[model samples]
Target: MKITTIETFVLGERQLLVRIGTDVGLAGWGDATLEHRPGTVAAAIREMSGHLIGTDPLPVTRHWQRLARGGFYRGGPVLGSAVAGLDIALWDLRGRFYGAPIHELLGGPCRDRVRLYTHALSARPEHTGEPDRARALVAAGYTLVKAAISGPVGFLDSPRQTARFVRDLEALREAVGDEADFGIDLHGRVSPHHARRLADAVAHTGPAFLEEPLRPEHSRLIGQLTATTSIPIATGERLYSREEFLPVLQAGIAIAQPDLAHAGGITEVFRIATLAESFDVQVAPHCPLGPVALAACVQVDLAVPNFYAQEHVIDLRSADSRDLRLLTGPEVLVPVAGHLDRPTGPGLGIEIDEDAVRAAHRDDLLVPRGTPRWSHPDGGFAEW
Candidate 1:
């Protein structure tokens, strides 16, 4: 069947939904939500659709090639995210057409369930505010949790700031004890020197991994950081293509954190994961977006043999969880005991609530990303 139409829906400040309609009564949905750049990604998707409309939806791989490399000027967050949205929607449509799940189309299931790690932001700076939140999630059947290291961090951080990050992680570890595995997200905020020092400070805590220890551009520095610390160094939520990831993979980092939305969707990330696998590294797709994006990541998680854990926004555990549930229609696969059972489907198992999607657009509920931009005491710009 050929793609007859491509549509985009902006649900207030929530999700940027992309829907692909086929001539044969099959429709697939995906979220193209790029933090702080939804409109731009949407426009990119519209531009890409010039090629997508009237094309066979079955060749997910070929479509990815055309959308990603077909453009003379290509490959950045905007185009990557745009191509990612269509790739997922096309996979969804292809799966429905085949009456199988997207993972089955890629390969078969490698594991019965995909394990997950949720966000653990602390209420207080020095402590993991409600340290019990980790316990509650563990009680709900999660075995792993991850949170950003708390306290303000600049190009260089002070002794007290470093200590506070340790304290915050310590609080979570102490609160959950051995009941769950904890991870530290450096979030590319610290200098390489500080990252190495922080790694030493928390080496005693047994964090499962230190995420984005340095920014994506610091591949060589990351190698140095990896050498200095025993903790597993994870990065690459920003690197878009296989070429960008080669150096870091060679650096011998343990985990690759490619975002489903930002890193070229299921098609490219599957390739990225396969590359990581050859290096004996594990894949933990970065997904803090909505259901369609998470669903796409889940499919890859099941198909890849080296998938370690899935990262989810803690909001999935919040009052907004209902809204997420609504957006997903009946394709919602909530994590059980911190593990999501392999999603079986015709395509990535997301069915768009077209009405809700349109209502959100009409209501203009597109959630603006309000991520903070930090600053030093003397007014030097700080990392967000």
Candidate 2:
């Protein structure tokens, strides 16, 4: 069947959903939530729809090539996220057509279940309460948890800032005790010097990984930091394509964390995982968006043999059950004992609640959110 219409619905507040409807009743949903730039992703989808509408959806690989390199200028977050969502929907379409899960379409399951980790964010340095959150996550059956160290780290971190991070790590380690693994997300908010020192400082904690210690632009420095620290360096959430990831893999980085929503969807990310495997690096799909994004990541996680733990943001323990509510019917997707059962249902395996999505949807807020800006105490601009 051919795609009859390509519609983008701004689901919830920050997530954008791309629905590719065929002349038949079946329609596949994908997420293009660009967090800070959701509107641009939607615009790219609108423009890209010209090529997708009224076309056969069977040859997804050809469709991917047409959507990606078919454009004169290719490979930015806006286009990548837009293409990512569309590519995922196309995969889902094929899977549903065959009455199989996407993983089976890829190459069948590598594992019976995919392990997951919950992300907890904190803007304070001394917030020792992260341990309590970790404990709660553990209680919810997560054996792995990630917490953010979201402080304004400058070129050089003072002893006070370093000590605060130490306290946070110490508390996290103490709370999780040997029962779970802990990862620290630098969020690319730290400088090169601070990243190295922080990695070394928390070495005793045995963090699962230090995520994006420096921005993707500082990838060379990331290799340097990886060499200096014993901890695994996980990145690639910002790296949009395989060529950009080549250097990091060559640098002997331990984990490849490409986002399904930003890294050209399952098609490219599977290729990336295969490339990383040769370097003895494991894949951990980055996903902190809505349900569709998480489901897409889960498909890859189960298909790749070298896959690591998946990142999940929908905390059943959190105040908002937005993830659960975003889907329709009984939720078959739930992590148990820190592992998600391989989805047996066809396609992406989760159904979108169109009514709830419509109810929560609003017109694009048409406000310009340029880039994130931050300043240090001394009045110089800092990377955020």
Candidate 3:
């Protein structure tokens, strides 16, 4: 069926959802949220729609190549995220048209259930609730939890700051003991020297991994840091393509964390997973957006043989929450004992609650969230 129209919805809470209507009355939805830049991504999606209107939505990959590579200046977060939403929508449409899930279209399931991980504690380093939060997550049946480091650090912070960061992780470990695995998310806010220092200091805690120990720009130095620590290094929420992932995979990352919503959606993330598999690295798609993005990630997690844990912000323990409010079939995604089972429904498996989506948009309830800004004591801008 030809794509009759493409529309974008700026839902509350910094979400951008795209709906592609087919001539045959089938419509597919996908999340194109880019955190602080949903509006810009929406504009990009509208711009790319010029090539998609009145075209076949079945040859998903061909369209991906045309939209993703056809542009003379292509493949940054904006274009990548725009293409990602459209690609995911096209996949959803194709899956529904074929009466199969996206994973089945890829090659059937590789595992019965996909393991998932959620965050614990506030990103603020000084937050004192890590242990309590960790215990709460463990009680909720999540065996893996990740927490970010304190907001910002200088090139060489004091020994006191370093020790505080270490202590925070130590507290989390103590709370869960050996019952669960915890990861340290540096959030690409540390300098190289301090990243190694923090990595060295926390090595004794035995975290599941060190996520984004250094920014993507410093990926060339990742190998050095990986060699210095036994903890698995995971990054790539900012990376958009397989070519961008190759260098970091070569740098000895143990896990690749491509955000399905931002990294070319199911098509590119599956390819990234395959590339990581060749290097003996595992795939744990980075998804902190809405249900559509999580559903897309689950489909990939089920299809890829080298799949690792999936990252999500969904409160799986909650029967009803903001993440679940937008979906009609949240049960299809809720994890049982920290693992999501295979879905039998077509497309992304969970159906969007169109009324709820429209209400969220109409009421402007999502608050248009963006990344918070931070500055050091001396008044210089710091990573947030």
Local distance difference test values of all predictions, in order: 0.80, 0.84, 0.87
Count of clashing residue pairs in every prediction: 12, 0, 3
> Which pairs clash in model 3?
12-366, 13-366, 125-150
Q: Rank the candidates by lDDT, best first.
A: 3, 2, 1
Ranking by TM-score: 3, 2, 1
lDDT of 3 by residue, 221-255 (tens): 89998888888999999999999999999989999
- Per-residue CA lDDT of model 2 for 156-248, tens digit only, reads 778887888888888888888887888888888888888888888889989999988888888877777888999999888899898989999
Q: Using TM-score as the measure, which candidate wins?
A: 3
Candidate 2 TM-score, C-alpha based: 0.95
- In candidate 3, position 138 carries an lDDT of 84
| Per-candidate RMSD, Å | 2.2, 2.0, 1.8
Off by over 4 Å in 1: 12-14, 126-130, 314-320, 327-332, 362-370
TM-score of each: 0.94, 0.95, 0.96
